[model samples]
Target chain A: EDQVTQSPEALRLQEGESSSLNCSYTVSGLRGLFWYRQDPGKGPEFLFTLYSAGEEKEKERLKATLTKKESFLHITAPKPEDSATYLCAVRRWDGSEKLVFGKGTKLTVNP
Target chain B: DVKVTQSSRYLVKRTGEKVFLECVQDMDHENMFWYRQDPGLGLRLIYFSYDVKMKEKGDIPEGYSVSREKKERFSLILESASTNQTSMYLCASIPRGLNEKLFFGSGTQLSVL
Candidate 1:
């Protein structure tokens, strides 16, 4: 079974505080890893796509890095508006074309 | 920007009633999907369509069916709504590749009473 697990189910950070969210996965063949930001009562918004290990992507205060077994989403000096649930998903090469997602890390940035 | 839209943001239906959740994407994506999210289970794929009239069963497709008459539209049908089926239904679209990122809609919160 392809499984994805995210750490720190709930996180609280003061404004300008930096933290990292973890996503660990076990799959047969990793096609891609994705990060999404979802607000309360809304759907997830696409953030980044990591294809291979050692790959990294950045957007504003958010930076994502991928490794062989896990991925990290680093939030630098986050603001209140950046508070949302961070979801990590992996798509395997099983031809199912389905993405297996983690439970997500709910971040609360207090300003 | 890629836009995925669902028919409703909130819906209330009784148990055993038939339900339909519609999703449409503005981008000409070849792949469209339907997922249900609960409080703890996260997001689980229910069904997906790779092409027009071509559908596939996802991880949790037991009580659901799908329709794809066009490239940009995918519909999810619940034959009989149940309390356990009350969840936030999400729709997504992606290009024709294994490594593509998905574009998601605002989601529909369905409450089964």
Candidate 2:
């Protein structure tokens, strides 16, 4: 079975504060790992797709890093507009083409 | 731009009543998926279709069903709405290929009373 776990269910950060959200996953074979940002009452917006360990991607204040067993979303100097739920999902090589997602970490950036 | 569109943005329903959520994609993708999101439960796949008239049960399929009569459209049906069924339903579509990501609709916030 494939599983994804995100740590720190909720995060509150002051503007300019930096922190990282953790996503631990277990899968038979990893095909891709994805990160998304979802606002309240809205669908998730795709952020990054990391395909292999030791890979990293960045966008503005958000940076994502991937390892064999886990992934991390690091938010640097976050702003109020950056407040949203961070979602991590993994697609395995099972041929199902389905993504298994973690519960998510709700980030609140207070200005 | 590629888009996935859900028919409704908000809905209120009565228990035991049948409900339908429609989704359409302009990306001409062969795969479409239905998922329900809840606070602490993340996104659980309810159903998915890979082609016209083909459907597959996902992680959570109880009390729910799906239809895909066209390649660009998928529909999710709740035979009998229940209080526990209140949730934000999301629709996603992905093109067939490696490294392709899903495009999601804005979502429908359904409240079953």
Candidate 3:
């Protein structure tokens, strides 16, 4: 079975603190890994997509890195506005477009 | 920018009543999805359509059905609303390809009484 698990269900970080959220997956054939940020009562916003190990993508203060077994979302000097639930999902290479998603990590960056 | 729009931001319906949730995308994408979000459960796929008149059931599709009569629009229907079915419904779209990012709408919060 294909499964995605995100650790540290909730994290409280002070403003300007840097941290990394983990997304671990077990699938047959890896196609792509995705990261998204969702605010309260809103749909998720796209962050990055990593297709292979050793790949990394960055946007503003967010950086996402991928590996064979896991992916990491690193937040650099996070601000209060950056607080949101980070979601991770994976697509398998079995010719299916369905994405299996994790439970997500609720991040609160306190000022 | 890719735009996926859900028709309602909030809805209130009574138990045993039928409900409809509408979603539309303007990027000419061939794939559209419906998901429900709840606390500690993240987002679970309910149904998806790859083309007009083609629908597939997702992880949780027991009490739900979908329609895709047109290329740009998808609708999720609840045959009989229940208290346990109250959730935040999300709609997303992606172009027909691999490794494409999904674009999502603002979402609709459905409350069942």
Candidate 4:
């Protein structure tokens, strides 16, 4: 069974504070990992896609790194506008594009 | 930019009533998906279509059905709405290829009374 787990269900950070969110997974064959930001009452917005271990992607203050068993989303000096739920998902290599998603981490950045 | 649009942002329906949630994507993507979001459960796939008239049951499809009559439109149907079925429904699309990144709609918040 493929499973994705995200830690720190909720986090509160002061302005300019940096922190990391974790996503651990167990899958038969890894295909790709995805990160998304979702605001209250809205759908998730695409962030990054990590295809292999040792891969990293960045956008503004957000940096995502991937490993064999886990992934990390590092937020640097976050602002109030950066507050949102971070979602992690994985796609298997079994010719299926279906994604398994974690519960997500709700981040609150107070300015 | 790829755009996925959901018809309604909020809906109120009574129990035992049938409900429809529509989604449309402008990216000409071949794959479309419907998911439900709940607290502590994240997002769970309800149904998906890879091509017009082709539908696949997802993780939680017991009380739901889907229709893909056209390439760019996907609709999720609730045969009989229930209180437990109240949730935030999301729609997403992805182009068929190695790029499995999905573009999501604004979502529909359905309330069953």
TM-score for each predicted model, relative to the true structure: 0.96, 0.98, 0.98, 0.97
- Model 3, A9-99: lDDT tens digits are 9999999999999999999998999999999989898899999999999999999999999999999999999999999999988655778
What would the per-residue lDDT of candidate 4 be over residues A20-99, giving only the tens digit for each residue?
99999999988899999999999998899999999999999999999999999999999999999999999987655778
CAPRI grade, predicted model 4: medium
Query: In model 4, which runs have C-alpha deviations exceeding 4 angstroms?
Result: none
lDDT of 2 by residue, A51-96 (tens): 9999999999999999999999999999999999999999988666
Clashing pairs in 2: none
lDDT of 4: 0.94
Candidate 2 global CA lDDT score: 0.93
Rank the models by DockQ, top first. 3, 1, 4, 2
Clashing pairs in 3: none
The collision pairs in model 4 are none
lDDT by residue for model 3 (B1-113), tens: 98999999999999999999999999898889999999999899999998899998999999999999999999999999999999999999988774677889999999999
Q: What is candidate 2's CA lDDT for residue B36?
A: 97
lDDT of 2 at A73: 99
What tens digits encode model 4's per-residue C-alpha lDDT throughout B1-113? 88899999999999999999999999888899999999999999999888899988889999999999999999999999999999999999987765568889999999999
| TM-score for chain B of each model, two decimals | 0.96, 0.97, 0.98, 0.97
